[model samples]
Target: MWDSRTPGIPDELFERTEEVPITKEDVRALVISKLRLREGQSAIDVGCGSGSITVELCLQTRGEVHAIDFDQNAIELTKKNLKKFGVSAHVVQGKAQDVLPELPQVDAVVVGGTWGDAGKVIELAVGRLKKGGRIVIDTILIETMYHALAKVSELQLADIDVTQVTIAKARKVTTGTMMLARNPVLLISATKP
Candidate 1:
């Protein structure tokens, strides 16, 4: 189990699957920071792959976390990671569009995958978010950033922020250490008003 209250629980600690992707630890830190969640706040993790973000949210918020994913494997992986972390969350295996409506208002929403419907996901996420609630959309593809940006702008959310994170981890080479770059992630954050 993770001992610290900080975000970025090492990437290896979580149960993972090759088919499902988990947001990296360094990137998770930024996502959690943008959330600005406090204890007792509720959050919805859309496309909760590997449940890394869900675990962080549960640990940080110490509140309710609804983890929704379209893939059953992702849901199972998320549940396993949650169990490993000794954190509990509402793990649901369904499309975001279908599951989001059933949940009550939430303090934050984080979208890790859109499955090609970034706009639709953002719309639903913003709709269920409470006033002053924060939303973070994490996209590895540039196309998603464009769609999310346009949708968030159309909604006229406040405090819109876009960031591109590039992390390079050091690897031990024969003589020295070399930096291995991971894929870049673009984050779009906004607050509901």
Candidate 2:
């Protein structure tokens, strides 16, 4: 696993618009580390908002990456970002629960943001995952966290773990450097038994 302290994607690499939230580099690094994807191993990125995480995943994995988003703008941004990075992926514009079943079984599934149906998405994703495949979910709300946990239990995934990443960055001030706290995000990860 790459050091979490090392940056994954610079904040400036993406063109953010239309309130599409891009994953910060720190959290992106955490998710990628947990994924542990290898060359020629396929993965899916659900709710790929600004495609920042999707781009990073594309760079890491030589296999096919399916970036799914319900929003049209997010779909376009993901395509643009992939083009900019000179990597290839199957950018799908649709809900995860619908798109995942159509795609081939993958080695990894990442739920970066679920649109209120965390359990259903988890259920669908786990069904499509190969044996011993890894699933990493990023949840910001308490409700989503609990829902995902319940699904993980129902699925009986092994090596289940959760990490809350609360990052603070240093900013230049007139007098000295100051710390600025970013919103905390929970990373709920597990592997198929």
- Model 2, 1-193: lDDT tens digits are 2322333777787778867888898899889899888877889899999898888887787688888999999888888888887777888888888998898888998997778899999998888799989999997898999999999999999999999999999999999999999989999999998
Where does candidate 2 clash, by residue pair?
Answer: none
Model 1 misplaced stretches (Cα beyond 4 Å): none
Clashing pairs in 1: none
**Candidate 1 deviates by what RMSD?**
0.6
Model 2 spans with C-alpha error above 4 angstroms = 1-7
Write down the TM-score of every candidate. 0.99, 0.94
The global C-alpha lDDT for each of the candidates, from Candidate 1 onward, is 0.94, 0.87
lDDT at position 146, candidate 2: 96
What's the residue-level lDDT of 172 in candidate 1?
Answer: 100
State the local distance difference test value for candidate 1.
Answer: 0.94
What C-alpha lDDT, on a 0 to 100 scale, does residue 64 get in candidate 2? Answer: 85
